[model samples]
Target chain A: MHELSIAQSVVEAVEKELESQPGALLRKIGLRIGELSGVDPDSLRFSWECLTRETGFEGVALVIETRAWQRRCPPCDIVFAVSDYQTVCPQCGTRETEHAGGNELDIAYLELETP
Target chain B: MTQIPMERKVLGENDRIAAALREEFHRRGIFCLNLISSPGAGKTLLLEKTLEGFAPDRRVAVLTGDIQTDNDARRLARYGFPVQQITTAGACHLDARMIERHLANWDLSTIGLLLIENVGNLVCPTSYDLGEDAKVVILSVAEGDDKPLKYPGIFHRAELLVLSKIDLLPYVPFDIAAARDNARKVNPAIEIVELSSTTGAGLDAWRAWLDRRAVH
Candidate 1:
């Protein structure tokens, strides 16, 4: 699954971040996955477990925050949450809405133990 | 016990490599396209037809990604254009690092157009950018008109939507207008092209579009 790759990316990012703080053990990883980011969080966590197994980071917590997809109506200038790819403005009934948010895949923060 | 705010992108490594690739492509004046679709969407056939149409006048090369076999690469190699296949083994999509590794030995200056046929999966490929000028999503008539809405992420990221297998429209239940409308709802600026590689229908327009964007 693509989640494996994403998990690997997360591991790499954490490893890079740890380079600055030597001997600090990773305790938790925080991620912000958007609805439209095409990532499955459950799968990511599973992959992360498999990847970190036997490593010092085993049992580390992965906290994922899911963001909802939002779109802005060009005519009505209304920003509304979208469940699907529904671009039709609920207020003005126009189909000229543009994407506003919910495409992010960021590693927000990390919790570490001072060794 | 201390929380540090990194605020870094998870795919930062891939994105950074992709940006470098994009800069290299721009410097070389090579127009690159990433073609994405589901399996059995006739991506190889369309590429074959495209190479046949663009070759002899333009320098074209291809990198096709798949989970197992390099059959698509073999099929495209018949067109006499340079072709390479990246077998993901079991991976569902192609990432920028894969492309960067594959292009390590290749010469980019001789190529005017480079078309990358991503591993056929609608969802996974959407998030991975391959340093292309455009991401073209291919939807066949056989796949139904509701695919854009069903897999909105790919449609939302694509710059062009190619409706392939128009020759089968008579037998299939696909509604082209509805597909276009759905795609537009997700991405209003996405360009649509209808073509059938089997019947040679709309190939000229596709070629024209390629020619206009391709650096030749």
Candidate 2:
């Protein structure tokens, strides 16, 4: 699954940050996954648990913030939040559509502590 | 033990590195394109055709990523162009760090067009930026026209959308109009090109777009 790759990137990123403070232990990591990012949050959480079992982040928790998908209608030129993948215009039935948001996948923050 | 709230991003490190790579590419005047699609969406075939269209005239080089097999690299080698194979082993997508490592051996100065063919995937590749000037996405008619709606992220981020295997459009059940419409639904500004590598239909338009891009 694509979650594994995202998980690895998260781990590597955390590791890089922890390198500067050699005595710090990762406590938690936070991420924001957009609805249209194509990343499964559940799978990423599972993968993170599996990879951090015996590592420096043995007990680190993962918190994910989900963002909703939004779209802009070409014919109406109106922007709206898309709850689903259907492209039908809400105000007008025009099929002309453009996704305005909900495709972001990035780590928002990470928590660490010095032992 | 107090919990310290450090606003450190988990991907912060990689993003910084990716930014550096983008700057380096800009400095060298190299335009890198990251080609992404499903495993059999005709990414390699399209690249082969693109290389044939503009090779020695433009000093083109390719870096192809696959789960396994150097077949893609081998295929491009016959053209006598600079090529590199990045076998991800089992990874589904290519990341910026991987490019940073392999890019060290490449001579970016002599290359006008640097194409980075990402691992065949419609999902994870959308999240990672490989320091490319643009992300070109391919969708084959055989894969169904609804793919753009199903995988909207890739289509939304793509600078250009190529509809491959158009020769099979007549035989297949795919509605070309619907596919184009759906892609526009995701990204209205996306440039769309319909082509068939087998019959060589619609290739001139594709090449013309590349010519315009290379000049710009």
Candidate 3:
């Protein structure tokens, strides 16, 4: 599954970040995934668990924040949340809309213990 | 116990490599296209047909991705164009790093058109950008017309939508009008092309579209 690869990337990112603090222990990772990001959170967590076993960061917690998909109508200038990948504007009933937000996949923060 | 505010994108690595690839492609005057679709969507067959239509003067190369086999590369190589296959080894999608690594020895300057056929998938590949000039998603008539609505992520990001296997329309219950409407709902600016590679029907229009996009 792609989640496994994504989990690997997450671990690699954390490892790179921890490289600066040689003896630091990773406590938690904060992630923000958008609805349109195409990442399944449950699968990611499962993959992360499978990957971290027996490693130094085995018990590290993963906190995920999901963002809703939003779109903005150019004519009406109304921003609204969208579900089921609907792109039409609710306010103006027009298809001339642009993505406003919720396509982000970011590592917002990390908790670590310094040695 | 202390929280560090990294504020970094998780896919930053892939994005960085994609940006560099985009720059390199533009510098070489190469029009690169990324084709994405589900398994058994006839992506390889369509590519073979497209390659046949290219003029001998036009320089074209293809890079295909698969989970474990080099079969696609072998198939396209018969066209006599430079072909490279990236065996993802079970990775569902192709990242920019993979493309960069595969093209390490390629002479991009001589290629007028570069086609990257992504691993046959409808979901994960939509999230990764491979630094292509345009992304095309293929949907065959046999797969039903609800695919556009069912898998909107790929359709939303694609510049063009190609409906393949039109020759099977008489054998299947597919509503072309409904499919077009659904795709338009997801992406208002998307261009649609319907073709049956088996009969060479609509192949000329497809070639014309490629000819317009391929950089000389």
Candidate 4:
């Protein structure tokens, strides 16, 4: 529902990052959105379109690299990705797993316009 | 193609604002809680009960958010506590700016415990931080037992899970054990308090949890 706001933030952040190169154009925006980020990539893409409809970012691409929920088994000394929010270790079947990662919501890179 | 590696958070602006709010809250010794849940999960009723339990002179305030209604604010005001309504118009979630704006004119020094009832949403509200000391997720027996698994983002991030509307557990097909197990699966350390706003059962335990922060 607030995807538009998120998309706007993305644009604003990119523009702020490119303040030194205002004349430089962007080709694509790479995003790393984890499964637990609570952001649907499709909805964000649609919102991106709505935001950049007639702007300089109109034709720029949004490449999203999605991630899975990852948990670390303490005794087993192993980190693994698990689906369905089940943190049970695949190797040890222990429930004492720590969250290793999967809440990523970062702008990975910006592909600038070709000369 | 000039590929610049820009590893930055998309919601950096909101996060910065939230961090500032957190610093201010910490400076003033204010403990704030952000409540997330799906619509009709009895967030308002639980808040109503909580306010009713507090003393009339308690230095507690509330900020309730809804997409369109001042009705919740009106309901929460009867307890004589300072309550502010954030009508987001059409936004599904409340950002830190909204909270900051609502708290702009208010006297923060007098507020020790601040409760923010977020707009009823299991998904969108999970990403936005409100500078609260903790995030409490509410799950009612009337909803699905698999909500913790389905909406793991919110469940995974929250510190406590309030299982509301438990009085109807017998009539509903929802499984309490499964619900608790699911919440634990995602968040092994999540504290849960089962209660019904109607029967007032387990309100003491809920109040006790609140007391740890307020009455400590």
Candidate 5:
């Protein structure tokens, strides 16, 4: 699975973001993953564990929040959650609804302690 | 522990690299496309057919990736154009870094169309952007019609869905209508092109689709 690669990238990004703060103890990291982002949260956590084992980043916890697929209809001016993979706007039967999200993968927050 | 509200993208490094590649492509007037599919979904064959149709002087090149062999590159290079193979070792997908590395030696200014055949796993490839103008996902009739529904990630992200090996539709249990419908259910705006690299059927439409997108 590519989750290992993803986990490595995420860890690297966090490490880079924390580089300026000397002796910053990164205690936890929060992730917001979309359903259609092609990342499995559980698998990512496992990968994170494998990457952090015995490293200086050991014992760092991971928090994940998942987002569902969404669609927004311009004419109806309504945002709707997608169900059963249906993207059509429920309000106006609009077929041109834009994909609002369901593919965003971001780091929501980082819990750390400065030594 | 203090919780700092980061709201940063985890794959920001990859995104930054892809953004740079996109800028370089745009600056060089290059039209790039990333082709993704499951293993044995006729990606290499489709590229073979596509490369065959190009004129000898056409400023088009290909970069094909696989977990191990250079066989795909060998196959595509038979058309007398520049084709390179990226062996990812065990990686299931090709990230922007792999693409940037392989493209280091190429004269991008002379290239107008650059086609990248990603490592053949639909799921992982969908997550990595290669700075292409569009993503094209290919599925063959040999695979189930429910493939699009099963792997909605790539289907939703791709701009065009190329339905390959359509000539085998009569021999197989694959339903073309159902496949198209499932793809549309996930992505209403995804374009579909049905073709067979073997019998040369529907290749014109595929070529035309490329022609329309390969703006100089």
Candidate 6:
């Protein structure tokens, strides 16, 4: 699956950060994975462990924060959480809803060793 | 002992390489396209038809990604074209690092159109970016028009949507308008072209798009 590659990318990202800060050992990686991001967190974490073995980020803990999709109804001006990609709001059935958030996959912060 | 929380994305490494790959492609004026679709969507068939059309003039190369079997690669190799097959062994999608690893020693200079045919899957492939100029998502009539609604992420991310197997549209209940409407609902700006590699229906528009990209 693409999770393997995403895992590989994560390993690479940690290693690159380690390169700059010499004698740095990765402690934790803070990742924000949205539900609509199309990434499975379980698979990603498993692949991360598999790919990070023998690397600087080996055994590093991953702190993943999940983000849910949010949408706003254009007509009602009501912001609500979208469980699925439905345009109509639960409060009011209208096709005037716009996507607000919940499709982000970002590495927010990294914990590294101190030299 | 308190472990310092070094929060960072592990994909940082691949991002750097991807940036480099993008720069390399841009410097050489190479227009790369990543073609993705479900299995039996006629991706390779479409490629064969398109390649045959531009074979004599355009310097085109294909890198087909699959879990096993070089059948697709072998089929394209007969045209005396450069084709590289990357068998992922079990991976469902193609990644940037895999492409980087195999592109060595190849004459990228002689290539005009670099087409990367990703393994057949709509879900997993959309998550990975292989530094392509555009991502073409192919959908056939047999796969149901509701595919766009079911998988909005792929449609939202793709630059072009090729509606293949149009020749079978009359036989099947594939509503072309609904498919286009759904895709537009997700992206609202995706370029769509309907064609059949088997019958050569509406291929000129497809060729024109390719030709336009090839020169620019």
Predicted structure with the largest DockQ when compared to the true one: 5
Residues B8-81, candidate 2, lDDT per residue (tens digit)? 54456667788998899888777789999999989888888877876476688899999999999999877778
Residue A106's C-alpha lDDT in candidate 5? Answer: 95
TM-score of 2: 0.87
Write the residue-wise lDDT of candidate 6 on B1-216 in tens digits. Answer: 235444454454555677788789888888899999999999999988877876476678899999999999998887777899999999898878888988884888987678999999998888777888889999999998989878877886788899999999879999999999888767656899999999998899899888786677
B87-143 per-residue lDDT for model 4 (tens digits):
999999999999999999799998999999999999999999999999999999999
> Sorted on DockQ, highest at the top, how do the candidates line up?
5, 4, 1, 3, 2, 6
Best by TM-score: 5
lDDT by residue (B1-216, candidate 3, tens digit) is 789998888878898999999998898888999999999999999999988876766689999999998999999998889999999887899999999999887887788788999999998998898999999999999997988877777887898899999999999999999999888877788999999999999887778777776744
Query: Order of all candidates by lDDT, from best down to worst?
Result: 4, 5, 1, 3, 2, 6
Candidate 4 residue runs with Cα over 4 Å from true position: B214-216
Model 5: residue B36 alpha-carbon error in angstroms: 0.3
lDDT of 2 by residue, A45-87 (tens): 9988888788767778998989888877887888888755555
Could you tell me which 10 consecutive residues in candidate 6 chain B have the lowest summed lDDT?
A: B1-10
lDDT of each structure?
Answer: 0.90, 0.83, 0.88, 0.93, 0.92, 0.81
The CA lDDT at B109 in model 6 is 91
Instruction: Please give each candidate's TM-score.
Output: 0.94, 0.87, 0.95, 0.97, 0.98, 0.81
Which stretches of candidate 5 lie above 4 Å from their native place? none
Q: What is the TM-score of chain A, computed separately for every candidate?
A: 0.88, 0.76, 0.87, 0.92, 0.95, 0.82
Residue A99 lDDT (model 1): 83
Q: Candidate 6: TM of chain A?
A: 0.82
Which candidate leads the pack in lDDT?
4
Return whichever of 3 and 6 wins on lDDT.
Answer: 3
